[model samples]
Target: MTDPITIQWTPKTGLPRRLTFEPLEKGYRRIEREWNGSEWRHCGSEHTTDLTLHPPEDPPTLEELISQIHGTWDHPNPAVLTFTNEDTVAEINGQLRYRSPTQDGWYAVTKTDLESHLRTAGYPTIHRLSETPYNRADFTADSIPRQ
Candidate 1:
């Protein structure tokens, strides 16, 4: 017997529908379900050996968040830049400190300032070492479980 394949389906309108193609003795059986607003309701189960299948791509391993690091002038309020996609995620957080209390907003932060901030934050400010994960999947599903 051929290994059965589960095909991902996209609806022509509205939300997508879930369907699978299971191999049968004579042909293939297409089992489909419908979304009734709240839960998935059974729609149809039929032999669909003639129909073509278009499977959707697998979901991404990680949700990548990206953030642009920028400096603050007044710095009474600071923001972090972050982005997340289905595939990957990245974040860039920053801190702004003046050389002296007298230093005005006119002074813009430089690489030197970023290093100092990292030092104060207990990171390797001089080497600018990064401990970002090599594999993001470990952070996504392998770590925690639902309570």
Candidate 2:
């Protein structure tokens, strides 16, 4: 068994991040991202059955990094779009229709796109919008008008 790999990333904003890659059962690999908070909050995880760790003899290059960041465009799945409002959706369908995550205030992405984005952004997984329907009645107690 090989030792786990650890990588540290310090973003300009928010908190520092740590990434760990560990070998898993059945020749699978697990990659986890955690925020270096007071409590070590978990950000996400990724599982791959065919992950290989390369030695320092061939380190990743800047082009590879850039490719990893922008390669989502070649994904087979269509991207999803999350809009803040109907207007934003309409605007996205109008001008920036080709682009996911509308320019105004929306996030659009397909699963592959999301995955690529997460991987490139150093996030293990991407959070999807809640599919469960929300109702006003469910929030009756918490619903208070702002004065």
Candidate 3:
């Protein structure tokens, strides 16, 4: 069974949109939404499972980077925050994950909720990622402040 995929696109000059795909029997159903000044409105849906509709060409959203921080364990817990730009998607322990370093499962939340939580936690985040190509999961913890 394929997991539900959420691809976020924050363009350089416009509002961002996040498309989530729920896998079905043969294909998938997608909910396309765009921010319309106040909130996200349903742009449309599709019968096909073509992921190309929300390609990973865009940069990682702040939410995606925050999820990585959620999985980032400092010492005792396993270091789960690994980076990969495979297919242009900056994924960490797979995208759209809600589990923290010590959690069992997940607790899904809305984008607004996520933003609030991350802000409250105050985990130092890297504002920019290097465009330089690398072979492995080459992310560093430089954004984290020293104790």
Please tell me which predicted candidate would have the highest TM-score against the true structure.
2
The order by descending lDDT is 3, 2, 1
Q: State the TM-score for model 2.
A: 0.33
User: Between prediction 2 and prediction 3, which has the larger lDDT?
Assistant: 3
Q: Which tens-of-lDDT digit does each residue in 1-147 have in candidate 3?
A: 689888889789988898888888978888898887899888999766445555768756766665654543332322232222211112344333333333333343445654565444533233222332322233322122213
The TM-scores of all predictions, comma-separated, are 0.27, 0.33, 0.31
Go through the candidates in order and give each one's C-alpha lDDT: 0.38, 0.39, 0.49
Off by over 4 Å in 2: 53-147
lDDT of 1 by residue, 75-133 (tens): 43222211111111122233222222222221234345434544343222111102221
Off by over 4 Å in 1: 9-13, 37-39, 50-147
Q: Residue 95 in candidate 1 has what lDDT?
A: 27
Tell how far residue 90 is off in model 1, in angstroms: 67
Which candidate, 1 or 2, would have the higher TM-score against the true structure?
Answer: 2
**Could you list the CA RMSD of all candidates, in the order they appear?**
19.9, 13.3, 15.6
